[model samples]
Target: MWKMKPSIALSVHFTVLLLTLSSRGSSPAGKETFSWVTLPATANLTWTPCFDTFQCTKLALPLQYSDPEAGEAQIALIMSPSNYSSNDPNYLGSVLFNPGGPGGSGVSFVQELGPYFRAVIGPQYDLIGFDPRGIGQSTPVLSLFKSPPEALEFYSTYPQNVNESISSFGRFYAQANILGKLAVDRYPTIAESVSTAAVATDMLNIAKALGQDKVNYWGVSYGSILGATFAAMFPDNVGRFIIDGVFNSHQWYQGDWSSSLLDTDDALTAVYDACVEAGPSLCALHDKSSDLIRARVNKLIDSLHVAPLAVYDDSDPSNISFGVADYTVIVLQIFQMLYTPFASGQVIFEALAALEQGNASAIWQGSVTMANDVDLATCNFNASQPFVVGFLDISAPIACGDIIADEDRVRTSDEAKSDYQRMADASSTFATTWYPLSEGRCAQWPIKAKDAFNGSFTQNTSTPILLITNTHDPVTPMVGALNMSSGFTGSIVLQQNSTGHTSLSGFSTCTAEAIHAYFANGTLPAVGTLCQTDTRIFENPSNSSGYTGVTITPLKRSAEDYSLGEAARALAGSNFLAKSAGFFGRRW
Candidate 1:
């Protein structure tokens, strides 16, 4: 995973396309003052206790921004003041929240994490959670494939042979295009409606609707991109803003999803290296870290390519042979498991070991289920199929049509494929085994490289912003976060030395203390400050006992909480046939 630094220019290009959209009119400057326009309260509105002891309400905004007269989309919004006193006009403004996932649901995340936030921010700020446009409980929720089976069908049947790959790619694109059109037909203008730019405008509108002139914001993952876009468009109105798991604005639009994959591989290798240093007692591969673990895993994947392994029970109609793609899926799955030393050393090792024994069920069946559950709980979309379909439906038209231009489209599929292939080839030591296995869907999806993807944020405004990142995050990657930090003029970066998707929720006490201090008193941590948290703390499953002050429950024994276990089983079962299925199917 550790490699020499590569130029971020290409990555930046893709990010810009993902975030920056060229508006018919220039973005509203942060310094610009706008008056609030109040609308009559609607009967459909409902209220609940805020996550932190105050009243919260769900508000509806026009589904079509261009036509305010059009019907509305419901957004779950929670508000809790810094102080509980009845009279506080001088109240600190509300801070809108986003937990990421162009698809991640904010309401649920707030419910789970609100207490922690309340403890940190104290009684000085009102925290708000609202589902983004076209997401959870928000009107016109985008549901793609009906079941995980449908998605698994597509991913499992993806073609690997040159001719088959080409035809499969074509079919996948055509199907996705059709699906997007259907979603648009069902909810007209929805594609153009869900852009981050539109969402930014919506945030401002929400602030005005709540009788506030300005607002503070906290966004994670995709949420960060949303927040940054808002800051770019309305810098003057920007209050205290925090963006965690920062996404590079440039790489987003350029259609380089590969970077995220590479980041995962790099992160995994980092863990593997650490395991080697920690010695055999801590890492299964032990003295064989470099050769036995890494090499053996690669060898198993290669073996699967030659002779697919049968992983399902003969009685099961859904049983199939495992191939290369399954291998990639399992590898990706293992990438996340590395978040803990025990998971990395034990669970992942067992899974990999199973694959070496020619068993594919361990990898294929579990991954498919995890992917599906992620979609259901977070985005309320189907992940069984290529995720591109859901993303394209909600993203492409806005990202591609508005921000990126037709001229900027990558001239040919061959060109784009070649670029990706080159990156894969350069990383042949690992990429050869994993990259091809992972890129089946993106390769098949219809994407035209856009020029708008090449731009960068010129945050000329003086508004104070805070950026947080995990030093070893696999998903968003540290480099991308650093790129965003450098783009902002007065922004500060807080680095948490830990592993995981985002740094805010799970981090070192030092980092939490710094963030809490900032939220309470508007103090920014010094740039390049490092907060250390040992990720291994969670490795001892019993640690949950201390936190919850309850007995640790075995996953298998708790049927009520078996939702996670079942989902993992489903994913593993479905993906059992792909080339890399063994990687995910094996048990610890």
Candidate 2:
């Protein structure tokens, strides 16, 4: 759930990452652009007309693969059908996507950005998005709260997340965790059923039902974990897989998060460097050096941690709606900014500047939502996105359930403290607020997977999957992408030299063209290939950079390359993810 403000209630506006298109247009080919519309439903609701040009349906897969009689879990699905016939020699088949929540909804992802993807990957493949079992629209959703309102109240008033006090941890550790047992106690079977491996199996089954022999896929963030799991579990069935903003699957499988922070500090520093580059006119926190800016920000954080700045409505002395701009809110906002820096990087800088002079508007997502009059009803969440509009506590179990349950998995409050310290060591600006998600989240996780895949990551799949990422991913580091690539022989890592969460987190023509090529043909980007983004942050919105793609092993640029770069330049200075509620997600 990304959009953050000091307030307890949160909501998300779905501008989830896909490339920032020049604008929706015709296919790269000469055909008219495919548009979807709201349509009436069929009585059976099986591959029926839905949301206009799309189709919606459900599949009942076994809750427990080992015990078919145990029962079945219904999987909600949606698809944007391709115009090209599968019989067309160049036509690729069905490509399925998972937006990395371990708990995120694939259905919602497709619903929001299916047309954009149709433009991105061309119209040959039938693009599909599904809510993994136990997630949005999927049956038996692993909800801890009875209703959205109750969940919103609990999250809005969450005491543990507000301060860095030991009591905060003790209270949160004691109370928030009961939901784990509550989950198992209530829906024992379904709670135990939503493992990644089981979902992988469901994907394979989904492809089979769709009459495709092998599954083509695109996954981001935690979706990387799901993609790698599928590749490892069903190697022969792999086809044109693309995993971006890679999560080190090894670390994920081990129930550890320490390794993911290697690039976090670097990412924060980059934002400061960019601010200095932009100068005082554009970047409010600009300084002679990045270090100076960091120091100023750090000093602010330290003072706030000691004594939070209380903001009030000047006319109304009693108004605490903006609450206190403290270390918790400050650092947590940094965590939010890290997801998509171009959309949010300057925000923290300006917020810090504003806070120094007594204003807290820029730093608060809740207040912004309020000021913008975004109906809180639109804030609903699925597993992949943490946009706080609606309810979905299943993220805890989806995460906790994956780790084969062990006594070592759950940490004591003291151990939790150490974990926090360790994460803090990794990211001084973070760890305080982020620890709960990366590691602390598992402290109360209860279930272990019975249908877990104990397979090795190194699988000689039918085709070498493609891996892409931003150089400075706030959550999943680039090294993790390299680490995961080592397992899948011949897998190429195409990086967009930019700071953000994933490939989609930034606009890179070189990277996009590389993706198009990979899907158009099985060609992979040459080793040591690096791409430049078509846009720059904190620049004159009118002055766009015409950066195409770059590769270390240089060759003459083609005419097509220039066109893509021109398209990307059209996107310069656009804050695409300013409201990206979630895709592939914030946590993963």
Candidate 3:
């Protein structure tokens, strides 16, 4: 699936909070400097133990930094100190990590990957993770739909065909989103303040609060956009920054969503090739051979346009029906799975094989599994608002805050359908369905950050930045990384000749080794370095975990999670259910 974008941009007052002499170290011209100091406790904060090794704290910063009196919002932060001896003279400083999604929970990211990071980055640096404003665990969390089920309902409203005839359904769907409408109406400030630039500023504030003089960062996907913004805004503070699955900051700020999805078609083809290469022993759909499998899959999708598939749902004790919209959602899920084909390969194979067999059980079963993973507290979904709004319900504002959108580019449902046709012509795999779907939603967003960065990308930073990417990343394509690298002075681009999203781990050992080296000593990989991917698509993983000699607990797949044959069920629904499951299950 494609990343979400806000439809419109409205100008609003911005608050710029600059760190002064007392807060920052005085460095000589063109050189980065930092003076460490502890932050005294404030009246507005509460600190609590997060885990045995980590402490969690909440800080209330001005909702609008430019207007301190406007109000304040709390952001959640979790920090774990380095295991290295504090007395060691060679102890490395703190490093900030972001897993992207603009809406992805950084707290969850740290909790899951901390040990892996500590091993790679060395235990000499503090690991810090925070939920960006309006995101997970942060104050004023944005919830587009009350629950995952509601999100599924919202997605269910999408028109199966792309044409002006179906525009009314889209309009009704947008207006019917009472929760979404209420959210935007109630908190306009968040919409205006959640841009990447603002988040980058938040990063700086986090560093200052932590008494760090310089910043070391590892950001992926949209996080790369934030890192780029941080580099542009506070160039001197930059230290050994690594941006993986690089985002084209220019494209992002300019609100060109289509550019990101242009490569999805090619990536999907690669998945097909990889599946064929795997053979029937490894790939569930391999019995039909590559071209035949594709034909059957396409036929299945086409057939759904005429009549929905009824899949047996053991829980419902009846058949669950899937409409064209539901079919599209499964397609998007397959596309996402292609990102980490090794881990998700089996899932994709089974899902598609079931589709070929006219069985809807696999799709319904996946939905139930996904529903179990969702946090009910975060999702306050009700029956009235049934939509599968992506992780973007919370993320779109941040995107709007960072980018300048052309109001004209924003489209009505009919216009969006037209746009979808053009996109489909270029890339059928994703553009046809996603373009129209996004345009309709984005057209309704009516705010933008006043201080969104659109300045010259060229800047004199304190150190060279490292850029990493996979050749066939479904979301952030490699070309964007190369384009971004050209703008940053001395930035090195390390291309991983692989298929996936981020290349730092599992996807490419060469890339991870290169990153480890850069972290140890701020030396860029030789320019034009092309790292080889060790994971084979169809073969058993040569190295299940990316680490050289470490074992990671594997995710268990249930025996009941099997391919469904042509069994009819009682329920009929759209593809949004599939996408809803993906909300908790990220392709990356």
Please, what is the whole-model Cα lDDT of each candidate in the order they appear? 0.49, 0.65, 0.56
| CA-RMSD of model 3 | 11.8
Residue 289 lDDT (model 2)? 99
- TM-score per prediction, in order, is 0.69, 0.82, 0.76
Clashes of each: 55, 14, 23
Any idea how many clashes model 3 has?
23
Any runs in candidate 2 off by more than 4 Å, and if so which? 1-45, 148-153, 156-163, 313-321, 365-392, 405-409, 541-588
Q: Model 2: per-residue lDDT, tens digit, 341-388?
A: 664455456667776765654455443224222232343333342222
- lDDT (Cα) of model 2: 0.65
lDDT score for residue 161 of model 2: 50
Per residue, candidate 3 scores C-alpha lDDT tens digits across 449-536 of: 7446756668778889999887777667788888888888999999887765666423455665677678877868898899886666
